[model samples]
Target: MSELTTVARPYARAAFELAVENNNIKAWSEMLSFAAEVVTNPTVEVILSSTKTAQELADLLINICDDKLDKRGQNLINLMAENGRLSVLPRVVELYADLVTEHNQEIDVIVVSAYALAKKQKEELSRSLEKRLARKVNLNCSIDKSLISGMVITAGDLVIDSTASGQLNRLSDTLQS
Candidate 1:
């Protein structure tokens, strides 16, 4: 993980706890997504990386956020500002997303294939993976033609590289050895 992600862990954990407690995971997800987007804007990104007062930066962000945050959302933003972790907003959001999904008993998987997959294909893939993994699978698909054929599926920290390119590389390595 990156330094920013390491720095953001506590904040994301706290937000996740609060969201789970209130059964407001979806709301918190949206709020964090919004916060991340706001922080990534060129103006706000510079402000966050500068020596400006936290209150000033918070005010500008709040204005840009435009009352999108409820009480919990406000608290998350304040917490980030107070802790000097304003720049970790993006990673914080990602971690929060993982927490929420895991709490909801879902496993997110990234499926990278050589070609574009249809909705039905993705759904079927999810079903197949869910049966094997024994968990509700959320499929995220991507296209990588260099794979030549097949797909690479990643869940949690595991990589199932079923793509021909990955297999060929492994075979080549084996032959070389």
Candidate 2:
């Protein structure tokens, strides 16, 4: 997966630059997302893995995407096809989305707690995180009954594990030490 990400990064950056230049990041994002879905289809996967020529693969993708892809998007397909990089479309889309998020100065945060958070609680948390992180926060909340109490917050590389289970584990480790 990491190898695919490495291979896809350059293409993603190129696509992002093109989008930025044209002020069409939204369109590019939609096109890339649609193309990724096409490449990941089970039937398409079989054809992609076969001995078809790069041109054939590229044509198949463009035809399937049809009106969803513009001239620029078609050019991207041709370029990636020529490089035998069509299989990396999904990763490319993922990286492109990350670039868009960074450009927007936004962060996606996941919060896992023993129970669902109230609307007011979620709003407060969002404001607090925005102040601390200096970016707009998009919160995704889930419940994990095993957490017992408190919650865990994850944003990019940052993680705050304040759950009762987490605390108990730490205390156990300390006593054993």
Candidate 3:
């Protein structure tokens, strides 16, 4: 895991647990997502990277976020800022989102293909993936001309590479061996 993820895991877990306890996962998710976006903005990033005091950093983030943050959300920002981990908010949000998806028994799947998939094809693919993974699947399709043909499906740590180029590479490796 990347250092950022390592640093973010605990914070994400805390946020996730709190959300679950409060039965406010949706609100927490929105708050984190918005905060992540704000922190990633170029202007906000410049200010965050400055040598401002921790309280100042927290105040800046809280002000920018306005009423988007609930009391708990503001506390999270204060804790992160005080610990000099404000920059890790984006990673924290990502990890927290993954936790929420898992809790909801859902998975986001990415399919990169040589061409756009038809509506029926996408539905079929989603159904197949849902059955195989035993989870609700959210399909995101994208075209990657380099695939030459076929597509690649990715979900969490799993990757299914059925592209023509991928097959050729595997076949070449076998023949060479």
Encode model 2's per-residue lDDT on 93-122: one tens digit a residue.
Answer: 999999999999999999999999999999
Clashes of each: 0, 0, 0
Once all C-alphas are superposed, what RMSD does model 1 give against the true structure?
A: 2.3
lDDT per residue for candidate 1 within 11-79, as digits (tens), equals 899999988889888888888899889999998787788887877777777778877788768867876
Ranking by lDDT: 2, 3, 1
Q: How should the candidates be ordered by TM-score, best one leading?
A: 2, 3, 1
What is the C-alpha local distance difference test score of each model?
0.85, 0.96, 0.96
When summed lDDT is taken over every stretch of 10 residues in candidate 1, the lowest stretch is: 54-63
lDDT winner among the candidates?
2
For model 3, the stretches where C-alpha displacement exceeds 4 angstroms are none
Per-residue lDDT for 1-177 in model 3, tens only?
599999999999999999999999999999999999999999999999999999999999999999999999999999999999989999999999999999999999999999999999999999999999999999989999988899999999999999999999999999999
Write down the lDDT that model 1 would get: 0.85
In model 3, state the lDDT of residue 16. 98
